[model samples]
Target: MDHRFVGTAELVETPSVAVVVDVMRAFTVAAWVFARGAEKIVLAGSLDEALAWKACRPDWMTLKDGPPAPGFDLVNSPGLLRSADLGGRTVVQKTTAGTVGALAVKEASLVLCAAFVVAEATAEALRTCESDSVTFVVTGEHGQAEEDLACAQYIARRSTEPETDAAEFLRRAARSRAATELEQGLRQGSHPDDGALCVELDRFPFAMVASLEGPLMVLRPCPTPSSTGAART
Candidate 1:
């Protein structure tokens, strides 16, 4: 796979298919949900939207979690998911960084939800695609960070020719403004519960793939490396 790791908004302009990463929390949790057994998933940009969707279709089933900023029900919580009954239902989720970044990349023909837990699965999945080029998009912590960069580079190292280390890429993308915003987010102490929930590996067979058509939260068991399959939570 010919892949490039791009660490900023500049990636929006890049023509290659982009894998939007929210590894520290968001996408990780989505992967976890798949492991549990969800039929489909949706990535919402706002709490209101997810909740409203849930209200309109109660039986459809939804996982409503996002930044507990304001007008939000709960932050992303993995512990909560473990106990809840998804029953192959659909989830509408938002988060501090994950969903928003995901929404931005939804325009891509193939937007695969990604994180550290499924790093190898994700990397290997992308390597099999027909796209001549792929890009790892770290939407960043707040907007840029070492962690998301590291996660993206993780894929870059495995599937592409990486020109930079995780830290360097983070430094290049972590602007003073973005860093301050990211720091303020840490101080808010708003979504602690959600962080712990999204870190499980191969937790979900669902890939949480998104697109202009909408999010396709495909659910299944862990892909047999021999089968080489991947889908969204």
Candidate 2:
């Protein structure tokens, strides 16, 4: 298997398998939503698109950042979603990086949304699927989003080397620019424990796979293959 890393929407070329990662929040939030029993998450390219989609399906819930948009059931914050019970509910998610990056890679045979929370499971899934080449899309910036990049590297390493420990990678994520900002936000009570929430390595035991269903990029959880053993938390 060939493992490599790319960045954001513009830089990602179609690979055999693509793991779109947004560790600071996006994919982390997705993992939490899935764990909370969300049926699926529809990835939208823009806030307007998300709202329009939600309007068409009144039962579908919307998750996105506020201030710029008005009709969302939840913000793109993992801390707020910690206790949410989204049993069988479908969520339409629009984010600045994560969803955009995911929608850009629809050409790939397999597209998995990833974060440290689901890193090991993602790697195990890749191995089980027998993918030839996998690209990690760090959906923060081209090269500056160290938190996302660190997660990509960790997943890549885990996919290839089964026995690797995530301690060092977690350390790197903590020192990233995004992590620093979230820490400051935590102290100010702006985001409140969101940084701590984002870095909870192996918090979820399944990989979120993005499938193109007509015009929607819907995400569903792919539990780690049972034969690959349990994911560490």
Candidate 3:
């Protein structure tokens, strides 16, 4: 299998499977929300789009950039989701990296949102789906965020090598520019707990796959496939 990595939305040609990683938050937050029982998540490319979604579906929780809006249930913070009751609820999410990258990959046959929380499951999905080539899209903050790149590299490595030192990878990613920024934000009393949650590796075991449901990019969780004991590369 051919595995490649690209920063931001730099993919020129689409691959059989596209794994989008946004470790600092985005995908990490989504995984946690799904684990907490969110029925579905809709990815919006911009804040305006997310608001439009909320306008149509008043029951859905909308999360955009900056602080949480007056009526919004939550912000794009992974730590906050841990305490939220999202059972059977639909969420509209718009982030700086993850959602933007997902929207940019219009040519992918399959799109999956990933973070360290669901890295193994994501890799197994690619293998189970018989994808010959996979592209890891590192949705870096603005330019290139180290946390996203680390998560992307980890997923790529896991696709070929089953045994991975996940702890070591998380440790390295925690020192990334994005992670550092979150840490600084925490110190400033801005989403203080989010920094820790964003770096929590392997927090969820299921992978979130994106499917086009009408005009929305709906994310649904899929159980990770068990190892088939076949040689993978």
Taken over the whole model, the C-alpha lDDT of each candidate is: 0.57, 0.83, 0.77
Q: Pick the candidate with the highest lDDT.
A: 2
**Per-residue lDDT for 1-233 in model 1, tens only?**
56666654665474447777876556766766666666556776666777777788775554444334543333455545555566667666666676776666656666776776666666666766678877777765544655577667666675554232344434432433433443455623223444433333344443345655434333232353544454433
* Per-prediction CA RMSD (Å): 5.8, 2.6, 4.5
Q: Which prediction has more favorable lDDT, 1 or 3?
A: 3
lDDT (C-alpha) at residue 158 in model 1: 58
Q: Any runs in candidate 1 off by more than 4 Å, and if so which?
A: 60-74, 160-208, 214-233
Clashes by residue pair, model 2: none
For candidate 3, write residues 1-233 as lDDT tens digits: 88778875477776668888888788888887887789999988777788777888799998755676765667777766676888899998887778888877745789999988788888778767787788888888653677877788788887778787777678778888767777787422237777677777666777888878888888888877563332110
Error of 2 at 57 (Å): 1.1
Q: Measured by TM-score, how close is model 2 to the native structure?
A: 0.92
Provide the clashing-pair count of each candidate structure: 14, 0, 0
